[model samples]
Target chain A: MVDLNVFTTTTIYASVLALLSLGITLIYMTTRVFNFAHPRLSLVAAYAAATFMAIYARSAHLKPNLEPAETSIGYVTVPFPASFYLVGVVAATVFGVVAALVEYYAILKPLLRRGADYLKLMIATLAYDFILMAVLFLYNTHRAVKSALSNPLRLTPTSLSMTAYDVSIVTEGGTFIAGMFIFSAALAVALAAALYLLLYRTTLGVKMRASIENPPLAEVLGINVERIYAIAWILSGATAGLAGYIMLFATSAGSLKPISATSPADEIVVSAFAGSIVGGVNSIFGSIAGGLLIGYAETYVTQLLQAITGYPEMFQYARVVSMAIVALTLLFAPSGLAGLLRSPRARRLLSRIPVPGRARGGGR
Target chain B: MEEPIIVVDKVNAGYEKLQTLFDVSLEIPRGKITVIVGPNGAGKSTLLKTLFGLTKVYSGRITFEGRDITRLPPHERAKLGMAFIFQLNNVFAELTVKENLRLAGHDLPASVLEERIREVFETFPRLRERLDQKAGTMSGGERQMLAMAIGMIRKPKVFLIDEPTAGLAPKLAREVLENVRKLNEQGYTIVLVEQNVKAGLEIGDKGVLVVSGRIAFDGPAAELLARKDLAKMYLGIS
Candidate 1:
C-alpha cells in the first residue's frame, strides 16, 4: 500500500521550501549578497500575519470556542475566521516589503556607497539577522504575556489561538490534508510562472537580466543599477513574506505559534539554502526544483530509516539527508544540477539531432 | 577642423592613487575619428577612461560640446550623448542579441526601440540572424559586431571605443575598421584606442601618440602616419 500521507506532506514542504529558495536566488543573483536575514524577514512576516489574524478576530467580535486554563489574565480567544487568511497574507507581504526596502535604503545602500566589500556586507547580514531574531523573540514574549500564557522561555508564544482552529479536508482516498496545502502549492507554482513571464516578457525584466549579467554595461546603457537592486530586494522580501504566511497558515490552521522564535528562521534558512545550492543558486527554476527534490528525499529517507530500525525516533535525523544532498551537490556539481543540463555537452547533444522533416536551422 | 565635441584639458587621473595619466588632454573633433595609438602601458586606455569619468580625476576639466563635465559620472556622461564600448566584457554574455539591443535602447519608446533595433541589424547584418542566440556563444568577430551594435543602438553623438578590432583575424579587423569609418560618415565623433597603428591611423583624421603616460605627439593622423620616426619611437610601429 502506498502511503499517500507522506506524498502529501512532502508536497507541502516542497512548496514552502521552493518559495523560500526563489527569494534567496533572486537576492543573491542581483545584489550578490548572501542574505542571512532573508529567513528572519519571513519570520517577521509570519508574526505580522498572526497579529493581523488576531486583530481581525477582535474587530469581528468573535468569541472563543474553547476556554483556556486559568492564568493571571483570563484566556482571550477569538474564534478563527478562515477567510481572514487572505488578509493575513497581504499584511505579511506588505510588512516584508517595507522591512526589505528599509534595510536596503538605510543599511545596505549606505554600506555599498561607503565601498564595503562583499565579505563585509555578508557579515553585516549576519549581524542584522541576530538583531531581527532578538526582535522576534521579544515580540513573541510580549504576545504570550499579554494573552496570559506562560512565557518562561521568553521566546515564541507557548501556544497560539490557531490550536483551536481545525481546517482539514477529507478526500475519497482516505487522504487527509489541510485546504491551505493545496492553496499554498498552487500559489508557489503561480508565483514561479509569474516570475518567468516577468523576466521574459517585460521590458523591465530584460533590463534586470542585463543588470545582473553586467552592471557596468547596464549603467552605461542607461539602466539605473541601484534602482534595479532596490527592486530586487523588494521582490525577494515580499516573496519571502508570502512564503512565511502560507507556511504559517498551512501548519497552524490560519494562525501562527512558532515552536521557538529563533528556530523558525534557522529551519527555513537552512532548508532554503540547501535547496538553492543544490538546485543552482543563480537560477530561480533550479532552486525551486532543488527544493522539491530535497523535500521528497528527506521524507523518503526518514521513512526508509524508520522501516529498517523499526523506531520512529530515527525520523528525527531526517535533516541529515538534506545536509548530505547539499554536500554532494557542492562537491560534484559546484554550479548545481542545472549546470549539468546547460553544459556544452548537453547543448551539443541537443543540437545534433535534426527534425524528421525539412532541413537544419529550421527556417529561422 | 570641426569644433571640439569633447575636450579633456590638463587631466591628472588614475586608479586608487596610482596615477596613470599625467596632465593628459585632447580635443575630440565633431564628425571625425581621432585614434589614440600608443605602446603597451602608455595609458591609452586610461585616457579614454578619464574622458568617461571611470578614472579618478584629481584635477582637470572635460567640456562636452562646451559644457564642463569633468566630475560627471559615466551614466550622466552617457545620457549627455556619450557612449563607451569597453575593450572587454562589453556585451551581456548571457543575454540574447535582441535582449541586449533592447537594454541598450532602454530609454526609447517601444516603437522607437523597434526602429533602433532595425537600424542596428541593418548595420551589422549578421547579428539579425542570431537575434535569439546568446551573445556569449557567438564567435569572436560576431561578438565584436554585437558589441558595436550595442553602442550604436544608443545613437550617441560621441562614441569612445577601446580596441574595437582587438583579437580578431586580419579580414575581420579590416571589416570592423570599415564599420567605424561608416559610423563617422554618419556624423558621429569617434575616439578610438587601438594597437593596430596602420589601420587606425589610415581611417583617423587626428591621432594622439602617448608614451609613458604623457602625450609624445598629437597632430593630424596623416602627419603622424608619415612621421615614421614618431611611430618607431612612441607607437613602436613601422
Candidate 2:
C-alpha cells in the first residue's frame, strides 16, 4: 500500500515547482540568460503574501483582557477571509512583475548594451540574487519591527494560515484530501493552460516566437523585440510570484512535506533548477514533467533511503539526489526528455493525438 | 539624376574595434538599381549594412530622401521605407511561409494584410504552394525568393540586397537577378552587393567599386564593366 500523505505532498510540491520552472524556461527562451535571481522572485512574492496576511491578521486582532479569566478561558483564533488570500496572490504577482522590470531596466539591460560576456551576465544575476535576498531579509526585519507580527525568518507563513477544510471519503480504507491541495493544484493547471494559449494562439505569441527564432530579422520585420523581452520578463516574474504564494500554502498545509522555506529560497531553487534541466529548458511542458519527476523522487527516495539506513537525517541527501539527477541528465540526454520527443518517431506519435492547428504534410 | 533618394556623405563605420568602411560615400538614384562590386576583403557588404544603419557609424551622415537618418536604429530605418535582406538567415526559419508574410506586414490592417499576402502569393506561386511549410525547410533558392517576397510585402522605397546569388545554382542565380531587375522595373530604388560582377553590372544603372575600405571608382555601370584596367586593378576581374 502506498502512503497517501507522501503522494499528495509530492503532487503539491510538483505543482508549484512546475510553475517556477515554467517561469525559468520562459525567461531563458526569450532573453538567452539563465536568471539565478528567479528563485528570489518567488521569495519576494511569498513575503508580499505574508505581509498582506500579517496586515489582515493585525486588523482582525482582538486585544486580550489584562485580567485573568475566571476559568482560564482560551480565545478562539479565527482564519482570515478567503478574499485576503486572493489579494495576497495579486499583491505578490504585482511585486514580482515590478522587481523583474527593475532588474531588466536597471541592471540586465545595461549589461547587455555594454556587450557583457555570458559569464559576466550570469555573475550579475548572481549578484542580483543576493541583492534581492538582502532586500527580502530587510523587509522581513522591518515588518517584524513595524507591526509586532511574527518574525518572517523564524516563523513560516503557517503562523497566519487559513483553515483547511478537508474532504473525507468513506471509500476503500477512507480517503482524505485537503481543500488547499486541490485549490493550488487547480491554479497551477490553469496557469500552465493560460501560458500555452498565450504562447501559441495569440499575435503576441507569434511575435514572441519570431523574436526567439531570429531577433534581428524579427526587429527588421518591426516586431519590437525590446517590448517582447519586457513582456517575457513580466510574465516570468508574475508566474514566479504566484508560485511563491502557493508554495507558502503548500508548506503550511504540510502538503509539500519534502520542502519548506526556512531561511530563503535556496533549497526550492536547487530542486527547480534540477527539474528544469531534466525536463529540457526549452520546452515548457517538459519542465512540468521534470519538476514532477524530481518532486516525487525527492520525497520517495529520501523516505526509502532513511528507512533502509535507519538514519533519520538521511533526508538531507535530497539535495544530493537533485544534483545527481542534473548531472546524469546533462551527460546522457543533453537536450532532456523534450528533445527526445522532437524525434521523428515521437513527433509522429504526437501527431496522432489530434491536436488542433497541427495539420500534417507541412515541411519541417 | 532626379535627386538621389539616399545619400551617404563621407561615412566612417565599423563593428566594435575594427574599422571596415573609411570615408566612403555614394548616392542611390531613385527607382534605379545601384550595384556595389569589390574584391574579397573590400568593404562591399559593410557599405550596404552601413547604409541600412546596421553598423556602428563612427562619423558621417546618412540622409534618406533629404532626411538625416544616420542615428536611427535599424527598425526605424526599416519603417522609413528601407529594406535589408542579408546573405544568411534572412527569414524566420521556425515560422511557416504565411506566418512570415503576416509578420512582415504586421503594421497593416487584417484585411489589407490578407490582400497584400495574396498579392505576394500571386508573385511567387511556389511560396503559395508551400504556404504552410516552415521557411527553414525550403531550398536555398526558394529561401532567397521568400526573403525577397518578405521585402516586397513591406512595400519599401529602397531595397538593400546583399549577395542574392552567393550560394545558388547558376539557373537560380540568374532567376534571382531577373527578379531584382523585375523589382527595379516596378520602381524600387535598389542597393545591391554582388560577387557575380558581369551579371550585376549588366543589370545595374550605376556601379560603385570599393577596395580596402575605400571606393576606387563610382560611375556608370557599363563604363566600369568595360574598363578592363579598373576591373583587373581593383575589382580582381579581367
Best by TM-score: 2
Report the CA-based lDDT of candidate 2 relative to the real structure: 0.79
For candidate 1, write residues A1-364 as lDDT tens digits. 5576656656777777777787888888987888888877877787777676666656665444444333333333323455666677788899888777777787777897667878988888888888887877787777444453322111125333332343454444545665556776787788879888988788888888888889888887777787888888889889888876765644532112243566556765777888888888988788888877876777787778888889977756767888899999989988886897789998778668776753544444
Each prediction's TM-score versus the true structure? 0.86, 0.89
Q: For residue A249, what is the lDDT in candidate 1?
A: 49
RMSD of each candidate relative to the true structure: 5.7, 5.1
DockQ for all candidate structures vs. native: 0.54, 0.56
> Which 10 residues in a row give candidate 1 chain A its minimum summed lDDT?
A147-156
- Model 2 deviation from the true structure expressed as Cα RMSD, one decimal place: 5.1
Total clashing pairs for each candidate: 0, 0
In model 1, the clashing pairs are none
- Model 2, A196-296: lDDT tens digits are 89877888888888888888888777677889999989988998887777666565322333112233367678888887888899887788778777877
Q: What is the TM-score of chain B alone in each candidate?
A: 0.97, 0.98
